[model samples]
Target: MRYLFAEYVFDTDRRELHRGADVVSVAPQVFDLIDYLIRNRERVVSKDDLIKTIWNGRSVSDAALTTRLNAARVAIGDSGDEQRFIKTLQRKGFRFVGAVREAKEPAEAIVADDQVEVQKVDLALPDRPSIAVLPFENMSGEPEQEYFAEGMVEEIITALSRFKSLFVIARHSTFTFKGKAVDIKEIGRRLGVRYVLEGSVRKASGKVRIAGQLIDAVTGAHLWAERFERDLADVFALQDEVAVAVVSAIQPKMIQTEIEVATRRRPENLTAYDLFLRSMQQYYLTTRESLAEAIRLAHCALDLDPRFGSAAALAGDCHASNVALGYTNDPQFDRKEAVRLARLALRIGDDDPDILSRVAVILAGMVGDSEAEIELADRAVALNPNSWRTWNNRGWVYTMAGLPEEAILSFERAIRMSPVDPLLHMTFLGIAHALIALRRFDEAIVALKRALRHNPSFLPACRGLASAFAHLGRDVEARAAAARVLEIDPSFTISAHIARSPKSPKLFIEGLRKAGLPE
Candidate 1:
């Protein structure tokens, strides 16, 4: 029998794992563990069951079991951070949560190594925005520059990976095709990415040039292209600049492609990742109905694949946003559920910048756990300093901790990293809040207005605008901003808002009160 999911096939009878045409090496114990999980995928397998079956009731340490489970995950090109296949159910054991299809005949029989081989594996393109950055070519004649070119590609890959919206191919997997003449179509087929970034780096005479082109791998379309030249004196800085430019150039292209794909595809045909993407679009609208729908779609994705940490994090974020904006009357229940989901996300995605930022933002926004939120935000930045979301969330953490100067700097960094980000309003809103705490009413008003310009319906920005105007003695505009908040969220109350933002300044609260908000 064989079980297939995503790009992998598990041949139980052959006792092997295969990714496309390539066989993946796995330890004997890992193979056994995977086989057991797939066979028992309908239910969670307890630790005792694992020991009883895999170890034949032998005494196994907890550490040994965890190691085997992690090994099994790594063997299948999955990770504890993503949990794309195996999922831990806290107290309950583990389950294989991928969408699996099984066949009675062994996969080896259909794709035999001998001349009798007749079958092929069908590769499905990943549902989300996916890209593979091919190894950059060394145009410089020196052989030593080869290392520099490879390092450039690695840096770009790392930077692209910081955006959770993108499904970036790992450096090791992509480097496999290095130094080889390959067709982009074949590369896309093998890698299962919709887009490919191919580039060449030339470095010599204290100068460097990096040229990149973004290709629509499916249709062989040249979507976008750019070139960057810089001094080689600071190679690392040049690499960083090039990576940022490449990412900034391609982000909107990918998002436009995603919008077209989502519009054309029927809802029934959507995958978990597709649903997650759609949910994100809805979440960005920042309207009551849209947020509710976003939460529903996020849950739908979670239902399809319970191990999807990103989906869980997004769902938790929506719940927290509801409380922060006074959209929920049951703040206590919402906060509890948000915290629970955030905790699960942290457990599964400790190293994912997006997950860490989402968890941090939701916790700090709704629960106001200053120390814990700050730690998570700092960890996120440490993990991926190039990620705009990490810096943006860190800014909020600092704001909630009353460190206005640090908050302002962090928000500025976030904007510089991803100036055209859709969530730029959130960064602006954070800056306004920080400036308000610093008693810079004029600057705070400008920042709040900027946020409102980007996202008119964002209530936090409205709240900040009202407070800033009140502090600046602009009573008419302050009252108008306060009215906008009530129009968006009729249940708006100063007490509830203050509870969500526990570290907000007393003066900021007084300004809101002066703007005629209900106490």
Candidate 2:
């Protein structure tokens, strides 16, 4: 793909930049950075977003990024003072203001045409287990309750989506099967998924009922099934409970599901719990107003039963989301409340993987409780080995504890479980970081490239790639990579990433400096 902007033409496929008749020789890394900027010229990219995209969440410094950006500007006849084409945002990132035009057919179309003969290539199925959540049928006579039933299916989808080890179809695409009587095999083929979840919901006489079954769509085998009944007042709670149960039942190795079903009994009155569960569905959507509404509904459930650990944990999740997403003005206050509620939930019923996993995330991210977080994450994984979140959390703990190799393994497991997951890109970044720590520059570059394939905007991957190039004496490519990072985050300093890193600062800095980062 070639992006024509002003008088300059950037050939992404060839990794070349052209100015009219002159071939402007730019380093491959610089070419990549310019290509990304031109491609994403529509919006102001943020630092975190860039890091996530370019680096795959690997650790890099602000100085490295700045040095590269300066070099890129020099290449383009643009300067920090002139600010003609690429404009840098203070806390945000960068924006390419030049008008861009494609110089060739779309890359997708070309690739499709070239690979048309190989399109029918059949590959072996992955060794990992996979499943999909089908839309639940609405047994309620009222069409207004469609949202309620849809909400139930959506909740299951979200919960399952968190399990990176599971291949779940997106809710938007999966819900298309609603109100249709389709073959499970057909659904699997259409979605490129292995398992399908089918269920029905019926509300009658102030009582709610739900039945769900998991099917191995390819083999046409019914892997798991369950039915639940609850008062209409607690319908929401029942839905959440059922979702958790269904997740457990589908995973052959999760024995805790049986224990939970055998020992934990539902509350006598389900009304408030139902409302809370429904509200949680809203909360998971991750909108500001929705989070507030979720909190309100969760509080209502607590009013009915202050001892409801699930509801309280969810409430804490709401606050944490609010704070994490920058929705709340006072993160400190929200963080404190989130920790308090999460702790309360753990105290009430810490054994539940759902509750423990939630608490573990809060403790690790918000409270910095490494020991407790690792323990909780370990327990969560022990309870549900197929859980993506469990592995993600474990990887997170390892990263923070400076155990990059362990973190890389955990992330690799997570990626194997959910190859298409956006977050799995971070695992690739983790691998690169570990490789870099072990002084394997070539391996780090390879891993970073893999991560960039998943998310082109990942800045950490870009930085790591630059470090590798620098260490290998590929100054031009290293500078270009560093420039791309700077274009995404001007304040990005290699020193800072090393300082904040959980690993040994001296060793981290030594490696980065050797990789060509300016002091």
Name the top TM-score candidate: 1
What C-alpha lDDT, on a 0 to 100 scale, does residue 506 get in candidate 1? Answer: 94
> Tens-digit lDDT track for model 1 on 273-337?
77887888888776777879988999998999887889999889888877766677677888888
Candidate 1 global lDDT: 0.81
Candidate 2 local lDDT, residue 50: 57
lDDT digits (tens) for residues 348-374 of candidate 2: 655556677778866765777678788
User: Candidate 1: which pairs clash?
Assistant: none
Write down the lDDT of every candidate, Cα atoms only: 0.81, 0.65
Best by lDDT: 1
* TM values, all candidates: 0.80, 0.40
RMSD in Å for all candidates: 4.7, 27.1
The list of candidate 2 runs beyond 4 A from truth reads 1-349, 358-370, 471-473, 494-506, 511-519
